[model samples]
Target chain A: MNPPEISAEILIVDDEEQIRRLLRGTLTAAGYRVREAGDGQSGLDEVAAKPPAAVILDLGLPDAPGLEVLQRLREWSEVPVMILSVRAQEQDKIALLDAGANDYLTKPFGGGELLARLRVLLRRPPGPVETGVVQFGTVTVDMSRRVVTKDGRDVLLTAREYALLRLLVAHRNRVITHRQILRELWGPKSEEQTHYVRVYMSRLREKLEDQPHQPRFLVTETGSGYRLDVG
Target chain B: MENTERLRHPGWGYLTALVAVSAATGIGYLIRPWSDYWAVAVIYLFAIVLLGLRLRQGPILFAATLCALTWDFLFFPPLYTFVVTRVEDWMMLGLFFVIALVTGRLTGRIRAQEQAERARAQRATALYELTRVLASAQSADEVLRNAAGQGAALFGARLAVLTAESEQPGRLVLHPSAALALTLVEQQTAWEFFSGRARSSRFAPPAAAGGRAYFTLAVAGRVLGVMVVQPAPGAGLSPAQQELLDAFSTQIALALEHERLRAEHEAARVQAASDRLHRTLLDSVSHELKTPLAVIAAATESLGATVAPADRPLVQEIHVAAERLRGVVVNLLDTTRLESGGLHAQLDWCDVSDLVNAALKIVGDAQLGRTIHLRLPAGLPLVRCDFDLIQQAVANLVHNACRHTPAGVEITVAAGTDEAAGRLWLAVADDGSGLREEQRARLFERFFRGDPGRAGGLGLGLSIARGFAEAHGGTLVAENQPGGGARFVLSLPLQHHEQVPAE
Candidate 1:
């Protein structure tokens, strides 16, 4: 994966001129090249003409909805996309994420939060990475060996808990919906049984986190889902 | 008056009968020398037949008797004496009498049948006119007006309509142009019919009291109203007229129901359009206000990087102020939604641990150096609720604790379930001073600020938290914990808990 020092090109597709300018200013200051599109059509055209390292697409656009643009882009490109949406649009955010967007930031987000989220998205590229080993907080999981160690000691985890941890580590720092987790961990028939995930998560937290209630890495997204915050 | 004319004066008919018999006698006397008594008898029968054409049964029969007597006295039997000389003459007299009686009876029956046919046609026309009038009426009010007017005309009576008030159910709306002033008892009777106690009533109030007939205006078992008709003094509705009135009421009820449905449909259409407009306006307003706030916060962050350390605090102030303004805008929108009855809970299954963590995330470490404890019990059953709404409520409580208490205070967030009561409870407790006696009573009032000097919100967080709780058929209450601090407990009903398979 390319680092920010490489000056990766970032495209911003938003209807508001001021928002685009702010985004451009923030990214350019953070050592990234920036491009702009005022509507969805131009955005799609720009992406087609020359794909950027990352795209920041606003949900609302004068020409077309951001979801359509994302779907159209996902048809051929695997470039990581970050969506900009309003606070009241949690459902739309989930839909965009499920539709191949890598991350989303609610509107009125501070520059620091935006950059932090973008950095994570960029660090974890679109295709699966060869993450043989991963570490967060005081815990380390060697994926290829199927072994998890906390503070230089082997920690006991049930088979389901180990699988859950693997899924979270696979997409570290990204929020996964309950539906997504259920489909992957159990069969799709158990999607409505969210308690399975909750019960298993509590056990994993007890085994790995110093204080299971105040988890450092494994985080809850309330109504949406769970996110493993490795930062 | 018209019905009286149809049954012409029997007195004048009797007088005409006498003149007809005398005319026959005069003609008989002139032809006596050249004619037999039978000839005189034939002339008498001719007069009786002519009188029968214009007279009813009683008058025509009188004419028959007179003509028969005149023939027997003047022409039959030993002239001018009441004696029967021959059996053939007596037989002739008897045959003539029988013929006269038969002619009178037949003519009377034909006239009566003609009158009955005319009456039927009149009723049919009246009913048809009423139907046309009611069908053309455009509104419920108009329908009632036309119905009453036509009904009054048809029955030769005054009519009053009492309808059920739609906006205020159970209240009655009496038609404005009602000519019949119903007495108290009559009104009660009308109400009884409207309420489905009676189908119809023939309320003939005694004496000079305004007697009336009441009919319930119903369609498909739903009573729309009641109709009261005050018949002309001393002229009550016959059974035939009552049946016609029944038909009249049925047509009126149908028209009223149609009009009501049309009005409801139009209102719903307008309301839907207005609701759509309201949602759009709110979204745009939020977007417009939030965009600039975002810019300000982001700009402040980037600006602080270049500013000297001494000036960084000023930039940070702007950032903090912008964030506060954003909160205010959100609160305003939320309150507006609540007041407008638009905040419907989109319920879903949720874990209490997730809810608590999300609230902490939203609070964002604003509680400088506070020691926050989590007491979420193991194996807490999942509860069904609107996840976002409950999260907001929990966040508001935590935020309220952070804002009201001094820095470094310990705030505990705990969750538990009351299985016996079928409820799930979440509490945010702070080791700050408990609420004052006066503040406890009005804490959840929309804009009631307990500590005016406190640098915090627009006094909306607690109120909004309560509203969200109620939306989930739950309750939020604030009381002093027994250990000398304030606690806000949000209890939500857990009715639909499912069986969790062992994992």
Candidate 2:
């Protein structure tokens, strides 16, 4: 498959030569302007010179720790920085993300996942969009009217279910932590009520999904939260 | 104390002798009319015996001579004169002197021998006590302080013990808490002794560079440190005292060596543990990383949609392989995090059906051609657990079964609460080969594969699955299905919840 027609330059900062080459081939094939830096210093220098539209930085760099570079960059630039984190970096990824990194992809990532996350980062920062009908897996949720239909048939849902579905649809591509979902649905005091979210999500899946057992749209991100896969 | 020796010496003895002789003569002269010359003579003789018992030979002789002269001159025909007129009186005086001399000499020798024996016993006891103290010391500093105090008391000297600091690597340190501390210069002397730059015999004092004396603390020819002492001026240790000091030094050296060996052993143990952890990571990462890499390598060589119409299969293989590799990596990372400690679980009151269904979907691709059955009862009370961890564990179990079971065999997944046990369990059973006794015993051990010949996986799945189960106050067990085949069960303690009202 050809890369998306994105003309914006993406800088990859990493120590692993093979990984840099793999990503370069993958990104170039996907129709994006790509730049490479071998170490943290080189990456910083390149960013200063070119000021790329986006940066994909490895958390473990050779010259300086990738986190140090990220912090330095965050001091000046708010350009979307997508980190390439490896396994066991759960804490570091969360910290980096909270510290202004736009997104992250674990090592040995599928080309499909990388492009998908890159697209999310490349898109302009999300703003509150007007309610509209959204279709996913034969289920159409008409948000303006707060109604849901599966396979052209009206599906019954409770008031809470509609609210839950609306929240997930709004942040469809990005993962919403369980605590965040609980707080949103059950109010601030209901942050500890994670099971409430799980029960409601199961009910919603049953009502809207053809195979509730095999979830295609409302997916659980293990050890994190949940993601709504729209595509 | 100087006069404590037999009063047979000249100084005090002569005074005592003069007093006895004069008193006896005055009494004899006053009572001379009450008796013959013999009566007065006997009184003077009695004075000689009293002086002989208390004084040495010189004083006794003076007393006997004075008694004889006084008895002859004063009690015989002539009085107040040195001349003795009677031979019998002279004979009597000589006989008394001989008897006095023999008794005093024999008794004095016995008293001197007893004093020497007592002193020897006291030295032996001091050495014994020092050995006891060193044996009980746990640290090198403790040994030094205790030894210094004991040595000072035993040898009548001010003592100091200095040890070489491990951090400073050859420089000596005097424990501030030690009983008798040495100057920094003195400690330098000790460091030189320990490092063998200064020569000193075991008990012999080191080079007389200063007023203080130094002895090396050595065991088996390995010098540990030194003890510096300043005995009372001119009151040097006897040969026996020197030997005892050497024994004390050796005892202290042995104790220090033991403490050092114990410390080294503890450090070696820590080093070994970290080494094993690193090796495990290296072995697992290299093997696991190469697997997906090999798959990606083969799939990319077939260049999807670029070379042939069969590009679809290669692309599908690539994605599947990539996802599988992702699972392997995630599992490895989770295991490392969990083992290294900080596996905080995010718990939710979850129905077992979610866990079973989620695990089934993830492991579905590995089923090849096997038929699966789900026997999870409806409305089972929710368990408080980390949903992701439990899901991963169940997925691992199903994956494990898929690999072991042959195609077309029935694989069963069942979940229910064991009320008697107050625990909830999710068990996966397969109609494949039943596990051997030995295999079942080590099934959950990390990197343990029942059949080493089988390809794929680092055999960490089952162990990690069990690890997750145990983390949630649960246990994972594999049993041979009684009828036949293998069964793996994950049992977690049930968390009582207020059931949500049904719609």
Candidate 3:
């Protein structure tokens, strides 16, 4: 999943000067080539002139709203974005994640936590790969054979259950909103039926995890969506 | 007064008729020497016709009779004789009397019609003036003043207006324009009508009930208030006048209702604008206060790794202080939101296990190597709640447990459901010394730090947890476990259960 070790660049788009300095210190200390943009227009210009490996975008910008910049950038770029935001703006976080943002960290976050989440965001491969088999904890899923085994024993799964598991596996380590789940599984008309995801998730946890109540691999983001942290 | 009472006294009409006939006799006598007897009769007829133009039926009839008698006695042939000598003279005298009666009757009818037309015009003018005045009034108070003035003049009465008080709608108070000097008994009667104990006396006969009548002013089934009018003694209203008063009451009611709606709308608009301003201010405060503390905390951590051994502890101290300040800021924001009625639970289907795990992770650093026991039973059904809020509440409980207990102590977290009550509960129990009596009394109070000497947090955790719990229609309670530690149990209701669609 690691890209070539030639030039791994990260672009930071934030209005606050001190925040930009702080982020630069953190990134450069971690041995990443860092680039900066003070406003949304400049940020877009910087990204278009020379694309970066990833972008750490802030939700608050002076020239235009961060959401608008994100929309404009997403039209032509597939660079992974990690949102930086304050805790008061919880209502908009879900929309950002659903709008192709890979992950997010609320303000006042610890330096170590930010780096850990950033590593996960950058570790993803740029293009889709066909993984014939995947494993987490004691459960093993073979995509080509359509078989799931736990501790060398066959585990029966319905056709719909297998489809649900494949969707999560495809977006593993990234947060996927309930709207995306419902639309992928039951068409767009079923967005209101969020209980469908809840029921299926519990069933999968019960079948695969050692303790279904405290799931390790399948994690819930609470108010946002779900994340499969296979790492 | 004379015109109104004219029909009551007919004797005065007869007296006037006698005087007029005597004058006519004198005129006829003077002309007798030069004219025929028929001409003398015609002069008397002329006098009766003039009286008819100015008098009613009774007076004109009297004048007609007087003319016939006077003409025969004073002007007929045979010099002041009562009898006529020839049949032709008798016939001529009879014809003159009949013609006088007919002419007088026709003229009297015309005079009565003219008087009726004038009365109608006066009523129309009075109503039009009242309507014009009421329409120009700007407020409810103005409406009351104008209505009272015009009503008293139009109906010849004293008027008082009573309206429901704006703040206390149950009771009614007199408006400033109440012109009627009401006695204690009359005021009590008005109150009775306002309370619906006594019905409105609309359409009652004029001057009924001691010369006072009450009319309720209402619009669209809502009673505005009552209007009481006391007419002058013995000057009661006619049915037509009563109808006009009804029209006035309707107009007054409409104006009052319009004013009330406008005031209410304006109040709502002002409140909405204030709420918006409050929200913007809070957002700015939260952003400004938390950003620098975040920088301090992160910067201090980075400085610690690279600093010399002697300076490492100093950097750590700064980090810890910044972290504590950050905690206070977060608590303050949560408290503000809770107090301002802005914390609404966005409920959705959530697994209790997930919430517990998320909470533990939030307070992970504070665990301090303590053993956490998870007793979440298998197959615990999902409950509906705001995932973020419930997780925060659980995290607060765990953090509270961690701070109160010594390092390496055990904390037990358990979960279960009561199917009969349809509730699922999660409890966090710490093996520290149980809470003291005084601490237990004010455990959930904001800023009530137990044992302030060992403080790390601003004691806002329990209150915020309770606030979040209540927001989800749930409850959080604290108690010392029987095994000698404090336990906080958060109980939440399972909102709904949907059948899983098979695929």
Candidate 4:
């Protein structure tokens, strides 16, 4: 069978030349076409001139506010935008998210983790669709019945574990923020409690993956969110 | 008329007795042709004593001379009453009148001088009592009340004290004695006195409110207020009574001045204490930030050095140390900002989980050996707060737990919502040596050290934590856990209206 062709483009916006260079090199080597902007206004202009499939935005911009840029882009575009910032404050993250950034990542992120998040963001399907019996490896998720089977046999899951698994399955092939998972499984106010999500996600991975260390379905986005590999 | 009626009657029945003795002597002379000269002398002495007792010196002398002449004419070889035939008899009568007049004048002068001295003594005693009463008063109100009451009693006049209000237009408070509630007019006159305006009245008729007597109370050219005293009905105060009132007013002024001084002193003492507390807070916070900053600087400098790849964990250690140091500095800055009136929160709706994780990152990095356990329940409400400040406060609590607990001890971060109270509580608990009862009392006090020998810290961690919590309309408390550890809890109001589901 022929390998799938890669076609999505990503824009890297940061003031630091080294960070921009590192991101460009990493993304390019991972089979992605990348463009760069030194400041916020230029990044906005670049997006306006030639819209990319995704954007990697730094919150500390030299010319304009990063949030403003995010807001401006959100006014007309639905392309996924990830905020990069040294400010790891919860309020800052909430503000960026509220301002229309899709996800947030703090500094000192690893290259592999960045690529994994980009891959998931780029692979999001157009809209919600009804699909029965979602399969990954030997584990099959029967969405309608709220059941899971591994090695063609039924698997037992607690009420909480089932809820968590269903949430990840619903947002499959896209980056589901930690806050989003918590809220969906629990409630809106439980978004700050990432620990709950972490515990249940561990349980789900242990049950379904052949080796949980190298998860095929549930993957951490590290500092941003989690993504379920449905492709 | 009363004085005249009292003088109308003869002051003594003894004067009549003397006149009878004179008449009897004349009769005896006539009956016995020659009365003894000794008998005549006794008659003259009796007349002199009678005059001296009844009238003053002049009258006594006249009566004494008349009796001597009568004796010479009737009993000393003169057959008729009026004829003084013997030269010796004439000389004796003249000496008697002179001696009688001199003794009467001396007696009258002595009696008048003694009465004057007694009046002076009475006035002095009244003045002394007035001074004593004014000195013992406590507040300005008390002083005014006492002054008015005492003045009225002492001088038998109605008294009112008016004191000035500190505010604009400088109004007066009229404190009237119970003896007489001042009329509205009298109060207005007192106000006039307060304004240093002169007014007078005869019995202080309402229209002419300034009564016969009113004076402004002044100290060093500044009028404190006024005092008004009206004499008794049907009679004005005597000159002496008025003079005494004036003297007492001066004493009142002096006493009021003393009270003012005392009040000023008390105000200054309170201001000094406030200033001292502010300065101590500043010094404590600055000192606390220094150590953390030094650690951050040292670790950051070391990371730039050439080290073996195998020793990269050392670099990670340095990075962790620096992050911990940064957390400490952030707490100190937060506390200082809160105390110095620089804490302005950019309040927003936040997920408590996000808040908890941010705090955990800072605090978890700082824990060198202890393991921190976080237990956050699902479905807690969003809290409206300054996220940075709340995170720092939590970080400070965690850092405190880490520092106090033994190596490998468990430190737990727990959060929950109190639905009834509409508040959220985040607690950090440590399984280590808990605080003693005494330490718990002052745990949140700035620069208070629980264990002085444990580490070199400025001891501002808990204080800052509490300050930040309180700044957000919350409370922070530290107590020993029932299971033998210390627990620090921060309680904050949950944002009910702005609750947003996490997405």
Candidate 5:
């Protein structure tokens, strides 16, 4: 089936006027209609009156309880909901998912990250479908033919290197938790082997970026997970 | 002849009696001529012996009178005649009779009075010693034992005191004695007495199985227990003994009450010490945790601004983790402050919606992409509260919901006024798995966690939140929603007048 176009109405719920204005401006710039709620209760009422395509929710409110707002919204609507919280515990993520949330984002996230997560939620693919050509900084990858060229010159990449690069490129501009990367590469039971992802990611950065120490494309989320900085 | 000398001694009582009888016989002979007075003299000797045994004073006086009469009748007249012809003889008889009567009466009265005074002195001394012993006894058990021993020694009966057990009902510990055997029913009675009930039993009398005693020890009109003493063989307690027992019982009651109060005071002192220590430890640990977390957060925030775009994610993670750690520290500090009377909320009249907005902003910036819903009315009245503190509490609830639930899950916050109850109700609900029965029981207790696996907290968020609510004359409660997830409700008294500053 063809994925829906990126035309959903996004509601920004935040107490800080600056943060709400920032979110409204960012979402509008990304070609989506935006509304704002200053607190949790107003955020819920806005969504209930006319269900939005998606909600960007803040976990703290003054007039009404934050968690209560989340729970009440889940009672009747399944409109994709994303949580905005400062806490980064694994249990928090798990609980939000169990409470009918679709995604989670920690604080201080940039506009790119916000947009990337939105795209993934709105356009979920049924299964892995390979696209033959890939492009980044002056580099083109042809997965079908197993060839790579930088600035139109043939560049050699080992078979292992290509596989690792393809995985990073596929989940570009979004965070891929260490567990997810490990499971995808070495099976579910070996997800705890984070060193393997680190070793391969280092090798990929050396081959692709001008500066491996501070690569523009590959980013580490430190204790939380890893993200691909594809801007 | 030696025996006759011994008999003539007037100081000896027997000799005095004999001399009086002989005199009476001589008088009778002398009076024989006057009248048949021999029988009267013999009767007088018999009366003297009987009176000496019964009316001790009366017998001697009677003997003296009879002697005088015999002299007048038999000796002062012609032989075998009842005639007193001489006036001198009459005066001599009268004088002799008066002397004899006066001597017998004075000696008998003096002896009787001396015996009575000695008995009174013995009783007084015993009473004084008992009072001294009771006053010095330190513990209830000591008082009981001493009382029993004194009762036994004074009354000549075996004594025992049964005291209430520390941890058992209808049970008592019999003080070290073999005087009385206690039955279950009697123990039950004693237990009732200790529990402020009056009970008495004749069936289980003192020092005898099934022989109840006369005196019951009581306090505040309630019997404490019984003081049991067996009656000495073939001897019941005298009036004096009974009075002594009653006095001992009163002392025992007073001593027991004093000991109980002292023990209670000691227990209270120990409890206060423990509470103070616990609070001190909490305060110190929280302070220690706060410093490091603040340092880390500051360091990370500065690093994020300077670091290259590629390294920003790592810096962000550090900042996030530090902030979370700071949240835990703040919770601990709040708890300690409440315990130590150090927390002071700055109260003000603030629009509830504005406070909600501030909390939502902080949570939103932190959450980034997560969804949360709110249902607040536009014209909600201003509430008197500590704005920053309430905001922090709300943030904690929202952050907790986000962490525990799955991504993109919705959380809701709602507020309304209950006019009938004259209160404001704010609720936070989540769609995640609800709290368990055990978790609900201890949800607000410090350092209690529902999920052990979850990391980065001291488990003080909910506890601190509840504490803040209570300080503002409100209550916070948690319950599981029927469909799924959990809901937390915070209710505060609606402000009718101008807000007052926090004291």
Candidate 6:
């Protein structure tokens, strides 16, 4: 049971040489093994021959649509995928994320942004409800005890706040839709209870964040939903 | 007048001529002392001329011969005798017969020629009227109705124009408003007419309506359609009338061709406009996208080897530019979809603070120097809306406020609900210099740059923002703030959702 576990490897499926080079250098320096495929067909073949721990697919592949490649890959494997897309296609990003890609990094992203997303995707445990301890900024959450600490001082949360925080921490760095949050905290029929999420989230951030107005850990994903940032 | 009426009947023509001559001879005898016997011969000649004018060739010839015989019998130079002994009297009798034959034939031919000319003139007038009506017709149905009416008047027939339908082969449809109907004979004629087996056909007796003639409508050997013509009651077509039917069928064929070409032209126009729209949409996006890509490339590429704590703003610059570019691109796509009528909102329960916060995330870093304040009541009810579209719209407003205002100005985004109005209000207020006095009207138009001095946008942000707002059954308006800067307010019909039952 104590035998050494091999570190995860990443596969980059993109047509742009600059994008691939940028990703490869950064990911290699971050201590993850990297592989590359230039077009969709070869990418699929590489994925088929030996599945990587994760895939970073560019939406505008030379051989086929990146979504098509993603759909095909989804048929064979459950490897986490992070999509690369130009900012021009917000609709496409939403569709790809909803289509089961783990996350997306819009084009013209810096090395820091790319690495942070990769860390979120690669480092998070596979199970959606894993419970232990997670730290973000100056705040620390103990999931088993259902407690949060800011600067080593205990922070108070109501029953609803604790539930929301626990759920967001379980899926930290990945966006959770408002509907999902409402449903999880308020039960199945509570998807329409968006204000509940908003109020509790603000209260939780106020207690946890150094400044409640400009949150450094709990972040809003604009049109998508919310994400917990571990900086 | 009685004699002329009699002359119209075959047997009665010559009988009437003989009777008139005999009556004149009797009168001549009664006035023997006063009237000359030669006067009786003159009366006989007048009777022959009347018959020639009224009767056809054969009857007029019979009348001419009968009158000459009656003159010899009743008042020859040997009065009341069949024989003429003198050469002078014999020559007189021979000369009278010759004059009668020539005069009769000449008068009959003149009448026939006059009737033919009158018929031809009427056909020309009908054709002129048909062309005039068809020229002003705007659509296929209008053309058919006018043609049917004009054709019925011109040809003395009830007419229907049947268009060959490609979808239902072997079946044709009459123009809906056409007042004409086809019998079995005309229908069969149309079937054969389409195959080029028949050109002009007449019905045996009509199965139902008064339809009689069927003429194939074609142009340059391409059979376009068919025309069913029913001769008017008591006015069955003559040979001349049939010729007119053929001519008018050609006119209908021309109109049908015009209708086909017009439909094709309409389809092509629609296709071309969409293509132009697509090109403009891409142009709006790409032209704006290039600058940000160049900035990002420049910023991120220099991140290596130029590493220093002071250079940290470089990463922030890339992040800001990337976000700014995303907003522009999103607006372009939305504008395209809106223009094409393809963008539809997927409405769901939404929160006002969520919209404000989301917009801040998008435009916050780019305009970091400016302060953005979000104000919302603690318990604003959920308004059903498409969250993404509303976010884009709000981002555009905030981004516009950022672009128009100089650094260090405060921008406020606030929301509230009006219960009585069943509406929700979201407004973005800026403290920078408000809208110019003259720029108010055209500000919401696409590609409208408020001031020439301001730079780096396609001017699509406001128009797209308004487009999103309107799509959710809402209205977006722009106005100058009382003190300074512009105020853009979006009002939506509120659909509030109830609180979820907790487990």
Best by lDDT: 1
Q: Score the docking of each candidate (DockQ).
A: 0.48, 0.12, 0.55, 0.03, 0.01, 0.13
Query: Per-residue lDDT for B298-325 in model 4, tens only?
Result: 3343443546777877777676655555
lDDT of each: 0.81, 0.74, 0.79, 0.69, 0.65, 0.73
Which pairs, if any, clash in model 4?
A: A188-B501, A192-B353, A192-B354, A193-B353, B200-B210, B201-B210, B201-B211
- lDDT string, candidate 1, B1-503, tens digits: 44665456558888998998899999999998898878888888788778777776677777777876777777766667778767887777677667666777787687778766766887798789988888888787887788778876776777788889867675577888688777677777677767767653423232244457777788898878888877766576766677777788888889988988898899999888877887888888888898899889889988999999999999989988897888788788888878877778876677787788878877774665788899998767777887778888998899889888888789999999898988899999998888988999999999888898866789998999999999999999999988888999999998564654555
TM-score of chain B of 6: 0.55
User: How far does residue B44 in candidate 5 sit from its true spot (Å)?
Assistant: 8.4
User: If ranked by DockQ, best first, what sequence of candidates would result?
Assistant: 3, 1, 6, 2, 4, 5
How many steric clashes between backbone atoms does each model show?
A: 0, 3, 0, 7, 77, 1
DockQ-based class of model 1: acceptable
Where model 4 places Cα greater than 4 Å from the true spot, the runs are A1-10, A21-34, A48-53, A74-79, A88-95, A107-116, A125-127, A133-231, B1-309, B325-329, B336-358, B373-391, B415-424, B436-442, B445-461, B493-503
Worst 10 residues of 5 chain B by lDDT: B201-210
Comparison by DockQ, 1 against 2, better one: 1
What is the per-residue lDDT of model 2 for residues A1-231, given as tens digits with 9 covering 90 to 100? 224556879998977777777778778877888999998888888988979888999876758866789899888888788877554333455466556666776555556667778887776644553477888889888877777899888998988888788888877766677677877777788766667877888778778766664567887654445677775
Point out the worst 10-residue segment of candidate 6 chain B by lDDT: B199-208
Residue pairs clashing, model 2: A3-A30, B8-B55, B8-B56
Report the lDDT of model 1 for residue A230. 68
CA RMSD per model (angstroms): 5.4, 15.3, 5.1, 20.3, 25.4, 15.4
Once fitted onto the true fold, the runs of candidate 5 whose alpha carbons sit more than 4 angstroms away are A1-231, B1-124, B135-138, B162-178, B183-224, B229-231, B299-312, B327-399, B413-427, B433-483, B488-503
Which portions of model 1 show Cα errors greater than 4 Å? Answer: A1-9, A29-32, A48-54, A63-81, A91-103, A115-231, B5-128, B131-139, B166-173, B199-210, B266-270, B302-312, B418-422, B497-503
lDDT of 3 by residue, B241-263 (tens): 66667777777888899888888
* Native interface contacts retained, candidate 5: 0.00
Clashes of 2: 3
